[model samples]
Target: MNQPDHEFPDESRTIRPHAGESIEDTRNWPGLALVAVGLVLLALTLTAAGYGFAGWAVIAGALCGVCLLGGIGIVVAEHRRVKAR
Candidate 1:
């Protein structure tokens, strides 16, 4: 009778999580918060700059733009961190 191979692969044994592993470490909460704040500020700035429905739309667009830029900045920073790791 032929016997089957019983050896497990090395990769399978190395998949355990580390004791200090944390989801928070990889998250950029502070950067995201800053982006939110910047968006609010941009909205306020646009509102202060005008009035009426058109003014509100302008303000919202400006705020969205600022938020987009801030998000891009945060994403770039995160990318750098990932590359470093």
Candidate 2:
């Protein structure tokens, strides 16, 4: 008997993980920690302004911006690094 025609090839056979791909998706813990802190700082910034601590609100906002940008930079860098190989 002939085998039945399939709709598509098995996808897993054609796909492979990048060499740099982490099973745990955990690179440096510090980067994840910074992202977490940035989120908290952003929340705190809004709270600080609401509580009338204008100066602290400004400082926290700036720090939050820095952390957000840095985390984004790290992600871009990792993507580039993996794709290059």
Candidate 3:
């Protein structure tokens, strides 16, 4: 009746994926995309500001803020979703 330790898995330490949910479903693609856009806009804003394009810098800076906020929101929402589940 003696079995080796390797014969059984330790359920307590194991993580199981939910049914009907693929690994890809857990990724926040949109959130990551928004963050990327925000970073790009930030670079543009700095460049414009350095060249004395006040209007362009202001516009890009505003857009960068919006994109960063939106991305953070999406990421938080996704985190809550997974936690709730």
Candidate 4:
């Protein structure tokens, strides 16, 4: 006997995208806080250190910290949004 071809897929994977309303209630406090902290630390470190290799290292670290924090916040928000759907 010949079986009819299905238009929709018979999925077994549970990681399929959600077919529901999108939850767009994202917060900015976390990323803002990180940026603020990073700026403050960079200012203090640069002011006290004056000019040297150590100062450059400190500045790099501050920038990296800010970027890492921002990335983390974004990841968390996306995770929440996906879970909500």
Candidate 5:
């Protein structure tokens, strides 16, 4: 069988950077933390609703909103930073 066109080759390759080439930093801890908090709050919200605890669910849902907004804010700030560069 032929491999799909979208598949990358399995051959090993070596990459060499030219002079003055610097590796870029690719860490996004704040956004990752916000996303993780949002996911945990999502689970809490679901569990609370399943247990018929409307109050807990509401609180968790509100926290979920905050986490989501924080994630969005991080993304927007990062985008602006990259655009400015």
Candidate 6:
């Protein structure tokens, strides 16, 4: 018994990387922005709670510090991801 001849295309193509390859930076910016905004709102709330403008200033200061920390974290994480790639 003779088997029927079947033709198949060659499949040995080499995949090449693009010239503009860059690492993806996925450091939740919106989330960080939300946290920063929340901090401002919280400070406003505190001020309205009769703690006076001074209390709001304090809250604002704290929020600023938190935002700084969060930004640093994001930068570090992005750096690590880029280095890993």
Whole-model lDDT per candidate: 0.62, 0.73, 0.80, 0.59, 0.71, 0.56
The best candidate in terms of TM-score: 3
Candidate 1 C-alpha error for residue 54, in Å = 0.5
Best by lDDT: 3
Instruction: Identify the superior model by TM-score, candidate 3 or candidate 4.
Output: 3
Residue pairs with backbone atoms closer than 3 Å in model 3 (clashes): none
Looking at model 4, residue 67 earns an lDDT score of 64
Q: What is the per-residue lDDT of model 3 for residues 1-85, given as tens digits with 9 covering 90 to 100?
A: 9975762334345555344332255467788789999999999999999999999999999999999999879877886676566
lDDT tens string, model 5, 24-64? 32434576678789999999999999999999999999999
Please provide, for model 2 over 1-85, each residue's C-alpha lDDT reduced to its tens digit, 9 standing for 90 to 100.
9996664433334454455453235653456677778999999999999999999999999999999878767765665564464
Worst 10 residues of 2 by lDDT: 7-16
Q: 1-85 in candidate 1: lDDT tens per residue?
A: 9997665433344554334332244566655776777777677666765665676667667777777687658756775665455
Question: Best to worst by lDDT, what's the order?
Answer: 3, 2, 5, 1, 4, 6
Q: Please provide TM-scores, in order, for all candidate models, with all chains considered together.
A: 0.42, 0.66, 0.70, 0.41, 0.64, 0.41
Prediction 1 TM-score vs. true: 0.42
Backbone clash total for model 3 is 0
Candidate 2: clashing pairs of residues: none
Distance (Å) between predicted and true CA of 21, model 4? 18
Better of 3 and 4 by lDDT: 3
Report the lDDT tens digits of candidate 6 across residue range 1-85. 9996653321133233333322233464644565667677666766655556676667666776677677657655655554555
Residue 37 CA displacement from its true place in model 3, Å? 0.3
> Regarding TM-score, does 2 or 6 come out ahead?
2
Output the TM-score of candidate 6. 0.41
Ranking by TM-score: 3, 2, 5, 1, 6, 4
Q: Candidate 5's C-alpha lDDT?
A: 0.71
